[model samples]
Target: MHQFISVTFSLLVITGLRVSVQAGETRPERSISRHYISELTVTNGGRWGSWGHKEMCPTGTYAAGFSLKVDSAPYAQTNDITALNGIRLHCIDNYRRSLNQYHEYSTVRSEVGSWGRWTDIKWCPSGFLRGFALLVEKPQNTGDNKAANNIAFVCSGGAVLIGSGTNWGEYGAWSKTCEGKGICGIKTRIEEPQGSGDDTALNDVTMFCCS
Candidate 1:
């Protein structure tokens, strides 16, 4: 019986079914090479609910991210502008990470009340994007912006981060002409055209410690 049991265990290991080995010396863990912040739904009425969600970002050199799903009709000819129109995405791991990593901010633009959506990839902040503050209204055109406030997790500095990276990375952008057909027709683009609806949007944010 003992010999039969040993043979069965050996077979399991050989076939890669299941097996256990003696504990070896622990090695340091390297950070993961990539990450994507996901599963975004929004309400313009929520409190710092935006800042409330950054707890999920694992530590490392990651691009910043945030998304929203809103009522398409209201967002199209969109109205109201406030910090709370969207959420504020910030970092908890603020020891080594600086507020300088948020870069290359972008998203596909859409305005559908239900199915289709848009991502507006644009320069999020002129200042360092360390922490964000969200309120319950949309950002009105202060003679600068021309569209309604779509629910978004604002990043501070997505451009500078992209320029500093050595490897070619991925990011969302305001596309007048996105490739169309990936992630609910949301993909990389040069212009974030605002239309209507919920799409798989993305924000390429740099990791940073808040001030």
Candidate 2:
């Protein structure tokens, strides 16, 4: 019940730098275009039951934690940015199949309304490995379906890690901003490049689905 494999991509992202993943090869040669991922709910509790839910970055703005591309093999497609190197799988095994293991939204802060703010960022859900906490929906007008609270960047729904600083500190935000409406925005559809270099500098993202 702890066997993970997630690589969903179509490319269309570019933020800070250093996206690495390929230490032991938990499957990250790149290939996935959007389906849903069996329902993504397996990191420990296990529940890839239905197997049909793969939407790996399509709406736009894709970026998670650390994906600076160092050996993902070649970046694959969409907007191609290959140097590929993604694979960390330790957040409790990285794809918990989903059920209950993601509820801690509010770490990188700095809100005043102007699209800019994140201090002392923090997102902990790797209590051994079992990820699923990348929920941050915006566009609140009181009638816009409401969604604006959830962002630590944790996706095992498959692939996405590009780092530089805790939620854009050293540098992140070159492009990818899910403003709001319908999907209501809230996708760590990360995209960095504001400062650059040394800020913990890490990238272990994995996603390849665009054939």
Error of 2 at 27 (Å): 3.6
Worst 10 residues of 1 by lDDT: 181-190
Candidate 1 structure quality by residue, lDDT tens digits, 15-134: 211111111212212222223333222222222111211222233322233333322343333341111122122222232234433322222222212222322222223332222211
lDDT of each: 0.24, 0.21
Top model number, lDDT = 1
Instruction: Please provide TM-scores, in order, for all candidate models, with all chains considered together.
Output: 0.24, 0.20
Alpha-carbon deviation at 144 in model 1, angstroms: 27
| Candidate 1 Cα outliers beyond 4 Å, as residue runs | 1-55, 62-67, 74-116, 123-128, 137-211
RMSD of 1: 21.3
Residue 189, model 2, lDDT: 21
Give residue 24's error in model 2 in angstroms: 2.7
lDDT of 1: 0.24
